[model samples]
Target: MSLDPAAVRAAFAAAVNMDAAELEEWLETPESLSVGQKKDGALESVGHAAGRRLVTLLRSDPGALDEDAYRLMRKAVGFIRRHRAQEPANMVTSRWRYALMNWGHDPLK
Candidate 1:
């Protein structure tokens, strides 16, 4: 089962600070492409895929979001929250920063 939608919404609001256009542009960058685990030699990492979903989620109406969308949101929220605590000394160009950005969060913001 997915997380509580209300809790997900609250955590999501706090975690996902980037807009759709901004996230879309970020996902196109080499930095965005460079980090995260890519299973079975797949081109895109899980975080990259989640960022794409966040972009879509940002654009979608809150009332119409499906459970799967909520699940994705919950996952992104958890990932963002956990990784945010592991911030590197070099926030600007660190792989940690890149990984978080891939999940639609710019800690620098």
Candidate 2:
């Protein structure tokens, strides 16, 4: 993703409304553990892993950010946007919401 750093930052901020504290807390939940794809019988889902990385990214100093960091942010923004568009009827407890939440997006918010 060769996105402009500023645009990626803005889009990411818009997509992931959950702050680091909120996302950190959410990531520890069983619901977070229960969703997303686990390729090749992996223990953790892709979104869950991304959430962990997102935590680190959220906590890092803005001045220290790099292209790789922006790339992850841009990718996350895309995932959140695409997933959000597929809003399920009962989002309160839907797996779709849970998956997005794992990626640091709380659709209900």
Candidate 3:
């Protein structure tokens, strides 16, 4: 139920197709991503991979996890910015488009 940094890091590395060491170097400051920190291109890649991992965890069966911890996990996942309004619509993948479209729908609806 707790956020396993090691498992998350491993999943991120595989999801992003980056070397674990390389990602470690890049994420060295995740706990302190400064206001002036600018990754330009690389951060986007990492964020997307991390976001996917987070989504997987968020979508997992609720009863299988600690509700309080899951709530915090969802909050943390919400912080990732994989989509930007300024991006052209065509720039988004069809999969992302579908996911984004469904994202706004109420699951209970």
**Where's the lowest-lDDT run of ten residues in candidate 2?**
1-10
lDDT of 2 by residue, 1-107 (tens): 36688888899988988888899999999999999999899999999999998999999998799988898898899999899889889999999999999988988
Clashes of 3: 0
Better of 1 and 3 by TM-score: 1
Clashes of each: 0, 0, 0
- The TM-scores of all predictions, comma-separated, are 0.94, 0.94, 0.26
Candidate 3's residue-wise lDDT over 1-109, tens digit each?
4566445444432333323343344334442132122266454343334434444544555455554434434433343224323334563433333232222211112
For model 3, the run of ten residues with the poorest summed lDDT: 100-109
Arranged by lDDT with the best first, the candidates are 2, 1, 3
lDDT of each: 0.89, 0.91, 0.37
Q: Which ten residues in a row have the lowest lDDT in candidate 1?
A: 1-10
Candidate scoring better on lDDT of 1 and 3: 1
As for candidate 1, its clashing pairs are: none
